[model samples]
Target: MKTKYQITTFLIALTLLFNSLQLKATNTIIEPDSDKDKLIIYILRNILTRSHYVVKDINDDFSEYVYNEFINGLDPNKRYFTQDDLKEFSKYKYKIDDQLLNEDISFYNLVYSRFQSKIKNAKSYYGGLLAQSFNFRKNENIDVDYEKMPFAKNENELIDYWRKQLKLSTLARIQSKTEKQNAALEKDPKTKVKSFKELEKESRLEVLKSMDELYYRIEELENDDWFSTFLNSVVGAFDPHSTYMPANIKERFDQDMSGKLEGIGARLVQKGVFTHVYELVSGGPAWKQGELEPEDIILEVAQGNEEPLDIVGMRLDDAIKFIKGKKGTEVRLTVKKKLDGSTKVISIIRDVVELEETFVKSSIVEKDGKKFGVIDLPKFYISFDDENYRDSAKDMEQEIERLKGEGVTGLIIDLRNNGGGSLKTAIEISGLFIDKGPIVQVKYRDQDPIIKEDVDPKVQWDGSVVLLVNEFSASASEIFAAAMQDYGRAVVMGGNQTYGKGTVQSVLPINQFTKFDEDLGAIKMTIQKFYRINGGTTQIEGVYSDIAMPNKYSYMKFGERDLEGALPWDKVKRANYNQTNSYQNFADVISNSKKRIAENKKFNLINEYAKWLKENQDDTVFSLNYKSFAEEKSNQEKEVEKFDTVFDYTSNLTFTSPTYELPSLKEDPVLADKRVAWHKSLSQDIYISEALNVLSELKMNNTYNAIVKH
Candidate 1:
């Protein structure tokens, strides 16, 4: 995706630096030398085979393709091509192969001669379609009839007739073209009236229509699975990374790369063709309006409140089509909520769940009316677009600067759900909080390690720092979190550990590619491993939080370490950094923070919810009764809804007749067996609460004491 960085600098050097290898050959692929020639020819022929797309030509230009592609080029607006080493690749730009053994070359030439006959046959196909428009019986070899066959006994039986016809058509086209090409090439120049160049170009053009027909027919056939696998095999010869991700694989790819889409923001899955909601993102639209819960089965969808279309057996993508609409325009989801572990319908309106909804929030925790800065650094995000701006990094920089301006003596940088982004931004942001030093070290393939450093030595708001992380903070987030912990810039706190993702990736966009049918998307392959400045590796084994807290997200089978092909962790020499003076004995300060939470009824509520989650992780079954089920589901929703509600810990707000306050959270949240999870995050959340406490402490430590000041 980044055009500035090019792969194969070797190719670039060859054109300018290497002066001896350049040589030309008569008719086949030539190269600077023999070994490279073999590799080049093998690569070129196959690349052209895959990239040559066919649509009815707009101009019927009759231009030479090799020139059009390599010299003359495809349309200039189609910027699929990057500047290649023209001098280095000049010898290899050719269409025909002449270096094969006499027998193979002769056969190849013969097959090319009859390729035109197939093209002529293709013209008849268009004529057939046009003739049908005028009600003419054109090609009477087979009568085209449309009567549904008797219901087949099975799936295999239904495909039998269609499969045989496709097979016949495929074989006839390939055979005819092969016979003609080989036949034409065998004749002497005297026998062939056209010059060698003209004859060769004509030969290639002749095969174009046939190649187009064969490729299309194979793709359009009934046996998509078999044909797709075959196409993969053909493409596989190029490289391991070249792949065709089918629809199913593409779905997972989209989810992994970008979890947000223009939808209800509820996680769902298809269970026996019925789409069911598994979880609702906290603060999302469905969670905003009360009554939606886990185990809600979607029965229908209405686009902008249109007719509620039943999606009982629709595929996941099809269901998404019915759910997603233009932002701000509403979509009505008729959900079958599980009541008492049984299903019932509940409707909800969909709207965009802005990142602003998930951003670090603040509240003035008044114990004797003292205020402290609570800054949640969800993730170190980079602006995704080079055009428009404002991402986590830029906005976070402004937030920290604002807190500094706000006279907050201490800050909390929360790093939960922050999967990381722009590596460049991470280092720049890390530089903001600390003096200049190495933020992260990267080791590339066969290259020495590169230390990405922050040059700015001036610190911003250096009163006291506390960073918050959970099992989900990863990748670039780990880099900043680990460095801050190692440098003692912040007292890092979280559950047992952060998510381990110590690998660095560089995305490679392929050469000689086009934005045609089935785009060859960029591949983000792992090219390096990352190491922290204090001789630690954050792969699989993530950086541990200095102050541990209780976590509800069970780490048993999740995170980057659990994934296949994850790179192993390793360490490098430590980078020099100046540790800051202790603003306070934060260990005792954190103890007091935990004490405040444990004593508060709110923290205790979190613990109750954790135990509930543990007991019911595999609790995924529900029933279909209407009345009793609905009531049962409502009660369970109350429990889940109370899992993190701050009001659950206190009798601060009594239940009003209308069920007052934010619908997303209720006061005096469920007091039963599910209220202990308040401490779920707070118990292990030493860095977060400590941040609150330390900010108050730092205000006292600074000359600007008695009030919040950095």
Candidate 2:
């Protein structure tokens, strides 16, 4: 549920540079030598330079940043482009800024052309390397710290690099296969096992197949895709959140923002040569059909009564084209079931799939004989096209109403891993917690900061409130959490700090800048920086938690602070807002939580585990020898066993849906299953358990009680 980027669209009028209104409307067909790329670059440079939140000079430093970003993006693993190739590229290292100023793509052209040849050469290297059996008995190591490792010096060294990489991949597969065989033998001594040589041969063939699939997908990418990558590098130079989306990616972004898609409703991921069903969208056509399940590999796809087209080894995008069709259309899929390894042909109707998980959902939990409501907000989602479409704020309001009807005493708004969406929704949701106040301050380039306020004076939930956040809770999530924290209306809990992403982005249609009918895609540019009502910005220094909890990512470098080109933290004049007199002993509650966390053995072990994970992440070197690798893995497993009780520590809490949801659960079995699974997870979650404890301990002040009575 991690979102790599956060975006929010706002209305803006752009002055068009081009006036060719009579140009016939057509899809923009970008080619290797198309002038369209130049036009795009020119438009982007003009727009970003003028309207971006942080106006940066496109100087030598900017050029160097773009250079590194583009090169690393293309060959992050140092698998292609040797030191000599980089030396050749150094000529344009400081000239990219000049190239953009002149709308010259000489650097991009050279790199793209060289990269294509490198891909072709590397394909041959992998096939030949995988064809031969790897001698894992060799005492060697592969350093996976690619960022620190220098590129290969020559073609021979590059090929040797690929050989080592391929060997590592094959070794992993062989080891996994060997372990499985051993496990089977342990279960029933009659199980026949393959020899070491046989396993090695099988692993090599598997690696070869995967390599073929990788190259196939790479070859499927067009000149436009590579150009888009280069363009994104240029945009990313401005900030980490700002991006240049090609037409296809922009279309997908729209779908994700709307949280609706017309398809079979099963998310698919390409693994090797097969498309595996990642997850079935709840309440979707496929989920309703009940045959399609996660991990089921789709072998072939067919239109109604049409010949089945084998999608094996096909690019995921290409396969998706065949699987997705017009609404109400029939699509048949030949799938291999993961549960029993049985193959079956399942027919599904393509329809508008409203992703249920994207919306707000709540569960009632009983701890210490008190009922509390837990709301898991994935993001601050909203559909700009459909006004009536359910947004997070609207859904959240409804869910709160439902929970209140069920007489829940406390509320926990779980914003963990919520990477954020609509800014309007965040403010609206914040309004639900407080009567009315300034939610956040937005500062545009060379402009005075404008305070975005919640004018609504009606409070939805005045009881004890808790906000759960992590390093992944970012952007609009930060805005909402900051607002609540500033108002002293909720207890913020989770990681040390939330994901620091205070920048605001608006998706500007590139076609609007031109009268040309060809769709030129859109650029999601950082337009503004948001500040908390408390005068602090959530940019790099995200909202600090009231009660910092131990999590897997606590000790790791993550969130906006770790991202390259991230905006810096700042502060502004605090907004005129009143802190709520909701709780009697807020500081005492926080102190008690800290005391409990320190004394808890589970939390101590988790902290230890987090440290261990950080240590493991830092150590990227691995032994290539089979015996050494096996020994290392055994040692890791044994070390990991010391923290096995972390998962086993379950809270004795009961979670259930509201009474109104019970009938729907009975009607929709899939929904029931989802709720059951969610409830089970909540029951086992130590975070939620501690939150319940805090909620129970929180004493509502006389002001809150008087308001409730009134």
TM per prediction: 0.52, 0.84
Best by lDDT: 2
lDDT for each residue of candidate 2 in 97-205, tens digit (9 for 90 to 100): 9998888999999998999999898878998888778888899999877888889999899888898888887887788789889999999999998999999999888
**10 residues in a row with least lDDT, candidate 2:** 17-26
Mark the 10 consecutive residues where model 1 has the least summed lDDT. 652-661
lDDT, model 2, position 612? 84
Residue pairs in collision within model 2: none
Error of 2 at 92 (Å): 1.3
Candidate 1 local lDDT, residue 585: 63
**1-710: candidate 1 lDDT, tens digit per residue:** 11122234523322331122222221243332434223323332333232211111212121122223222111121111213323323343332223321112222222223222323443444333222111111211211111122322332432333332222233223333444555776774344344433433343343343334433532332322322232232232222223333345344444522264435666675543357764455446665565665556786666664545666545566677777765566777666544322233345566665555444433223323443455555445444446356655566666666655555556666676566666777787788776578888876545566788988766665567777787767788888888887766677777668888776543333222221233333332344567888767787888787766555554234465665334556677776665544444656666666677567554456556656665554354322222333344456668777675632323221111111212424543432112133223333343344455554554223422222222
